[model samples]
Target: MLWPREAGKFIASKARDVKINMEGVRKVAKVIADAVQEGKMDVKEFKQNEVLPINKGLTTAQLADWMFLINTLNFNFWTPDGVPKFSIEYEGKIHTGYLAMVACVNRAIDEGKKMYDPHYYSKLTLDDIKHIFRSDTPSTMPLFDERVRVMGEVGTKLIEKFDGSFINILKQVSGSAMKLVELVISEFPCFCDVAEYEGQKVAIFKRVQILAADLWMLFHGEGLANFTDIDQLTMFADYRVPQAMAYFGALEYSDSLHQRMVKEELFKSGDREEVEIRGCSIHGTELIVEETKHVMAERGMDVVGINSISVDYFLWDYRLNNAKELEKIPYHRVRCIFY
Candidate 1:
C-alpha cells in the first residue's frame, strides 16, 4: 500500500469531486505560522485539554494501554441528523462525540473495570459495552456492533501477539513511528485504514497515525514515546478536518458532492467521492505544512515543531471552536469503521 504521504499526493492528482485551493492553503498556513511564532502550536496543547487522559497522571504503560484502547474504538462517532449525539455526562459536564467515548472509558476505570487491559476487554460481551458506554443522550453510539468487534479483535491480538500490551510493540520499534504504524496495521486488521482508488492501494491509516501521535504527546516525546519519524505522519484525515478546510476555502467540493453533503447522504467506505474528500484533505494539509514552514523560515522564525500533525490539530480545534459557524458547511457523512 502507498504510504499516507504518497497516497495523499496521488489522490489529489486524480481527485474529481474535490479540489485544493492553494491560495486558501497559504492563508491557513499563515495562521499556523503565526501560532507557531507565538509559541501556541506545540504538543503540550494536548496536556492543556483536561478532557484528555494525559492529565490523569497515569504511568507511561497505563497511558499507552489507554490510548491503545481508545483509538481502537475511536471510529464512527458522528451521529445521524436530528438525533441526539452519543453524549456522556462526566464530572458535571456533557461531553459529546469523541470526548464522550473517552469519558466512557474513564468512567469504566472509575467503576473498577480493567477497561484498558486486553485480557479484560477481549472478553467483553455486547451488554458489557452497552453499559460501559451508555449515553446520557437518547442516541446510542454509532456502529456499536463494529466497535465491539474491532475492540475484541484488537484486544485479543494484543494478547496473542504483543503479549497483551501495545508498549511491547513500541519497544520493538526502536523509536521509529513509521515502524509502529506498520506493525499496528500488520497485526491489527481493524487499523488497516486503506482504500483502493483507481486500482492503487492508498493508505489513509487515520487511527494508526493518531495512535503514534498520541503516544508522542503522552510521554512528551521522551522515554517510550520517542518516535524518530513522527513528522512522516500525514493529517488524520477524517470528516471534521475536511469541513474545516472547506470553511477556510482550502477545499472545494463539486456541486453534486456539496449537495449530497447538505442532504447528509451517507457515503460508503471506499466510494469515489469519499476517497477524494479524504485524500484531498490529506494532500491539502501537507501543502499547508510546507507553506507554514516557509513562512516561518522567511521571517527568521524558528520552525522547530511545525508539521502536518500540528496543522491538523489546529484545524480540528478551529472546527470545534467555530462549530456553529461551520455548520453552514455540511461535512460529508460516512458510517464506516476505517475512520
Candidate 2:
C-alpha cells in the first residue's frame, strides 16, 4: 500500500510527458551562443564579467547559453555550498548566514494540479530532458495535434481548468501537452525578457526578491513548510516529526524543485510514522522520532511538535501549545490526489 510519502514517488503527473525538452532548450542556447561566438552578437552586453543576463532580453535561447556561462540555473534551485552563502550588505554590514536555496521551476499553466509531492527523491536527469523533445512526442501534444488530449479526459479537464494560458506556448515549443497547465513560468523570466506578452521591463533577475516572496508563500501554504507542534508529517497522523516544511530545494539534482520538495516532505515528517527528519538543519545531526514537544517544552522549549498531514493537529496546537505567535494564517493546504 502506498502511504503519503510513498504516494509522492508515483507523481510524474505527466510532467515528463509534457512540455519542451531540455534538448530544445539546449539547442536554443546553442543558437544564441553561436551568434555571440561569430561576433554576430555584442559581447559587451552578454558577458558575465561586465553585465547581467537581464539586459539582453536573454531570449529563450540565450537562457540555455547562460547555463554554461553563469553559475546560476533556473528550474534547479542550487547555490554553491561553502561559499559566503547569501551575503547582502545590510545596514552597511555584510550579514551572511544560510544562503537561500535560489532555484526556480517554471510551472507555466495553472491546471490546479497538486504541485507538492509528499515523497520524492532523485533529480530529473539529462536523459529526462532529451526525452521531452524526442521524435516520439506524446499523442496529446498540442504540437502534434491542435487538440490536447491527455490521460483520456485530463486534456479536456485541463482545457476547462484554464485552457488558454499554455496552448500557444506548447504549440510553439512542440506538439506535446504541458504536464501541468503552467509551462516553464519561473524558468522563462530568468532567460527571456518577458514584456507582458507585450508591459515595462521587469526581468526575473531584477525581481529575485519578488520571486522569493512568491515561493516562500507557496511553500508555506502547501504542506511543505509549516510551523508545528507535532511531528512534521509522519506516515501516521498526530505522531510525526517536529517542525514545518512543505519541501526543500532539490536544485542540485533536477530541473524541477517540486520533486525534491516531495522527498523533503517525507524527511520532515516520515520518521517512525512520527518524527522523521531526512537529516537536519545541520547535516551531521540526527534525532529520534518518539521525542515529543511536550517533552521538549518541559525543558522550556515550546517550538517542538509532531507534524500532522492535517490541520486538525496543527490549528489546535500551533497557536496554543507552541510559540506566542500572533500572526494569523487562516487557510490551510488541503491534500488531494492529482492526475
TM-score of each: 0.96, 0.20
Those runs of model 2 whose alpha carbons end farther than 4 Å from true positions after fitting are 4-289, 292-295, 303-339
- In the range 1-339, model 2's lDDT, one tens digit per residue, is 222222222221112311222333333233333433455433232211122223334343333222211111212211222222332332233322111111111110012211111011012234432232122112111111111111112222323443422223323433211211123333332222111101122111112221222222223322311222122222211111112121111101223323433334322212212111111111100111122233334445332222222221222233233322422211111111110
- Residue 301 accuracy (lDDT) in model 2: 38
The global C-alpha lDDT for each of the candidates, from Candidate 1 onward, is 0.87, 0.23
- The TM-score obtained by model 1 is 0.96
Candidate 1 lDDT over 126-179, as tens digits, reads: 889899999997887877788889888999888988888888988999999999
Candidate 1 residue 67 Cα shift, in angstroms, is: 0.7
